[model samples]
Target: MSIHTFQLHDLEIGTLHDLLLDAVSDTKWKIKELRQTFDQTDQAALLEKLSSIEFNKARLETYTELLEQIDSSWCPDE
Candidate 1:
């Protein structure tokens, strides 16, 4: 199968393992960022808001990368 075929298959499948992996990856990523923020002496009171903002930022990055990948290979109405 081609890479495009594989990507299409991946997008179609919504397995429990994928959901769990994404959640685990996001949590681990957030914790690492928070640790870095603490090491840099960021304000404590803003951490709650920072976490929310960071979560959105991380997801946006993931989405942008996915779009970029599709842009490189995807052909509309093919």
Candidate 2:
């Protein structure tokens, strides 16, 4: 087996928070598009895709909430 090496650095909370926000935005857009597609189509596979997209949207929203909480409580005023 081969091994991997990497470097570590301090946690950039602000950057992380921004990334979470972006993820939430992207997921929401996808959910919106999928919903529109779902409304236009009448297929089982499309339903499944919508379900999956909604699930992911929920997960991203949850993460965004958590990040907001952390930013409010832990991050200092800027």
Candidate 3:
């Protein structure tokens, strides 16, 4: 699968949040499947991937909130 890259300034908060949520959800589903199959190595890899995804999702949420705050503070009322 090809990964897409985005500039932080270019992404809207909602879009970034949605993308991260989707990634976490997908990782969780794969982890569940690996667990059912009783594949120790695959299960370990999936668990690691799930952990990383969750960490990244938290970071993205923090950044998104900060960006929204900055935008609200700096932008004028229309």
Candidate 4:
């Protein structure tokens, strides 16, 4: 039998939201690590580069909202 690939639309909203949240969480954790490394390193140029990099706060808020919406949609009726 041949293997098949499916699109993201085939997944439930909850699954997609979970995946995005996990990715965002991982990225944030990595950023923290980078910050720590920058703090420990003595290279001024590297520290300046790290300080100049900007994070997309709006995108983060959007992902958080999406995760919240998915959780609310999946919650069982009380």
Query: For this target, which candidate reaches the highest TM-score against the unseen true structure?
Result: 3
lDDT of 1 by residue, 1-78 (tens): 111213434662244246436756766766777777777786873486476556655555555455566567767795
Clash number for candidate 4? 0
| Whole-structure CA lDDT of model 2 | 0.60
Worst 10 residues of 4 by lDDT: 1-10
Give me the displacement of residue 2 in model 3, in angstroms.
1.7
- The residue pairs that clash in candidate 3, if any, are none
Provide TM-scores for the models: 0.42, 0.47, 0.49, 0.44
Cα lDDT of model 2 by residue, 1-78, tens digit: 111121123335565566567767766776777777778785875786676667666666655665565667685569
lDDT of candidate 4 over 1-78, digit per residue (tens) = 121233534656766567567657755765776677777885875564444333333445555666565566675868
Model 1 lowest lDDT segment of ten: 1-10
Pick the winner on lDDT between candidates 1 and 2. 2
In the predicted model 2, the residue pairs found to clash are none
Q: How would you encode candidate 3's per-residue C-alpha lDDT over 6-73 as one tens digit per residue?
A: 66567776876687677667767755765665555667666776666576566556655656665776
Q: What TM value does model 3 have?
A: 0.49
Superposed by TM-score, candidate 2 places the C-alpha of residue 13 at a distance from the truth, in angstroms, of: 4.4
Q: How accurate is candidate 1 locally (lDDT)?
A: 0.56
Model 2, residue 63: C-alpha shift (Å)? 0.6
lDDT ranking, high to low: 3, 2, 1, 4
lDDT of each: 0.56, 0.60, 0.64, 0.56
